[model samples]
Target: MTRDKILVVGANGELGQALLRELGTEKAIAATRTANTPHVGFDHVRIGSDGNLPVATLKRCAAVINAAGSVAGDDQTLRSANIHLPRVIALAAKNAGVPRLIQVSSFSILGAAEYIDRTTKERPINAYGRSKAAAERLLLESSSDELSVECVRLPFLFSATKPGLLAPLLSLTTRLRYLPTVAGNPVRRSMVVYADAAKQLVAAAQSGLSGISFVADPRPFDYALLATILAEEADINIRILQVPRPIAASIDHLLPALGRRLLRSSLLDPCANRVGDEPLGLEEELRKLVRSTYGS
Candidate 1:
């Protein structure tokens, strides 16, 4: 029996590679820009310079994963990958009778609302987020019965392959036995590891789940617990020193910028509907991430 074919755009990218691993070659066809991409021998769909994808092949796809995007680039590059490409894919998918189109987005689109929900309007702080917000709007507008377009607005996604914010901090684990964090850090934000995000995206494709969806652990995330996990995974002392406010302030500059940013209060409301699930909780995901990155 023939299995469902999922077309993964940006097949050479971090998330695209993750999705390829999740779906495997038998089920997924990687969409690359040129035949000369790193993926030399795989089922390929070469998107054109004009943002035109071959609609004929798209007709056979059960789902199209619009994973092509740029996290950092010039304005034209961001618009091309994050906005125009998605619009082009959406129109083509609509015409090709594709059942689902899963577009990758970012939580940055909403900026730092004290608590973000579906009702929250996008107020991106950076060019990347702005591009994503625009892309999401275009995709959602293109959604219809024939083509269900759902943009997975990812938060702090990490993995061994793409360590993201975790790389520098995790490296510090080797130098410092215990990380000194602000005591009673209560900030909770959406987060997902790369593998899980890929799995969740595949599920969304199969289920034809549509609309804008924020992603990550739906439960309360504890910074102290996360610090411990990072320490252990990095093969350092698994002690998280929760320094008091007065003490923390004396050396708060020691904290990495990303670390300070994370400790700040910004959470997605628990009631807000999101896509990815963290059945094993955020701690386990962190464990998986560090282990993968360190090859431990």
Candidate 2:
């Protein structure tokens, strides 16, 4: 094993795989509790639990990239994976004297946890978001002074493997052709391609930056605008169904519990919606997603 080892947690995941791809040919370890299939050159190690992460895994690692997240796992499982895992990883890294840690966190951490009622605040309406938010806090409050941790709060991540924000919404609209545009559901929003998000993460890891970075498309894109693009580019035709704002939020609140999870993620998910208003740009890099996904 090379002295400069990078351990990528959740290497089997879409973003994790992308991050490994970005690392390309570097001496790295890919870990997952799930069975690992072929993924580039790295060997897969099964960590059934966060506490089960092998010490030898950390012994030779120079940096640990935590791309681990649980979307549908049990509440305890999700909490263990998201919150407990990061803390354990940080502690391990600190003990091993690793220099940097790159944690992939969710954009939802910035939600109105303080302002909105806990019941209504969109901190994380689903198991996935809650896990990520808790994990983000763990990473933030990590006790490892030796670990230079970089937490990236990411918006919707797009890739061929997993549907991005636009693709899922577009998929839902494909059959219906029309979607209700509610007052609160901001049509324009910011998102990032999985590849690009991975690239930025790798870059940040290489740069040795120790802080939080908000990663997303540098432009405001609305669902209406996105729907139009998909219809034109992907050749899916749909109508815009305008629903009331309160109804949309209400629907967002009840859908998961009722098992009627939105076919397309809620545009009203508090964190995802606020990204549109942040200071971002229409960089040349972002236009590539349009071409790649929608075609020229």
Candidate 3:
């Protein structure tokens, strides 16, 4: 029997590239805005011009995976990339007779929820979160017998190739002998290794499960533990100074921008802390990332 063709949108991104690596080049069709050169070790099609998706290409795939997102765009750009793009893909996939649509969504949509699961309601607090929530809504509402949609909500993802949030944290911790943090250093948050997340994404695409599912590391860690682990691995000594949360909250209240940033930080206010069955170990995954990136 012949294998079904899978289309991956935003095939040039970190998650997209990871998915391609997991799924292999033979079974996947890479779609991006520009097909000028090879992408993720595969030839790709320029699926969109400006802001519109290529309906013709979408109609030909057996399944579609949307890994595209806008992390730091203005209101209009955010809406277009996060909301409009996914909406278009869902409609085109439905029209094209595509059976499965896997949307790589974010944990930001859940905001500061302590324990996030499929049943947890979305309470987006920022523009990016709102846009992602809106996109997820559109895709879930658009699901049908012909087109099954699944949204995989992911936490902070890290890899050697893409350090992501870890890079900054590592830099800050390594440079300072003493790091000051809010009182919530023990607040654990969900995280996943990029390679592990890719496996889950591929499983979701092939499993034919519908609705929302969260993929995360088996264990959650707080800022203090994270700093200690990094310091020990890097062979450095650092002290963590915990300030009062009330003082930090007061400062945040005085400065709106800082308040927003603080609210978004997983260390200060975690969104997800639940674990799944046979999940990856947090320390093991962190060690892999550190070894790959820093060779320690």
List model 2 lDDT by residue over 1-296, tens digit each: 54477788888888888877877756657888777643856766776554556777677777888888776678888887788888887887787777788888875654423222113433565677877767766776773567788787776666544554445555566667776665544444445666777777777677666666666654544555655665555666667776776777677577733222232232323453223444333333333444565566
Which candidate leads in lDDT? 1
Total residue pair clashes for candidate 3: 0
Query: 1 or 3, which is superior by lDDT?
Result: 1
User: lDDT for model 2, on a 0 to 1 scale?
Assistant: 0.64
The parts of candidate 3 lying over 4 Å away from their true place are: 1-3, 37-43, 50-60, 179-185, 251-275, 281-285, 288-295
On TM-score, the stronger of 1 and 2 is: 1
Candidate 2 regions exceeding 4 Å error are 1-3, 34-37, 48-52, 111-122, 143-145, 164-168, 183-186, 234-296
Model 1's TM-score against the true structure: 0.82
TM-score of each: 0.82, 0.72, 0.84
Query: For residues 129-204, what per-residue lDDT tens digits would candidate 1 score against the true structure?
Result: 9999988888888888888888887777776456676676666655675655567765555667777778878888
**What do the candidate models score in CA lDDT, each in turn?**
0.75, 0.64, 0.73
lDDT tens readout by residue for model 3, 1-296:
23276788888788888778877877777888875523545646776655445666566567888988888879999999999989888887787778899999888898866566556778987899999999988899998899999988888887655767667666776777555567754446667877788778888888778988777876664566666776767766777767688877776679855543333344312232223456575667676666665677
Better of 2 and 3 by TM-score: 3
Once model 2 is optimally superposed onto the true structure by TM-score, how far is the C-alpha of residue 32 displaced, in angstroms?
2.3
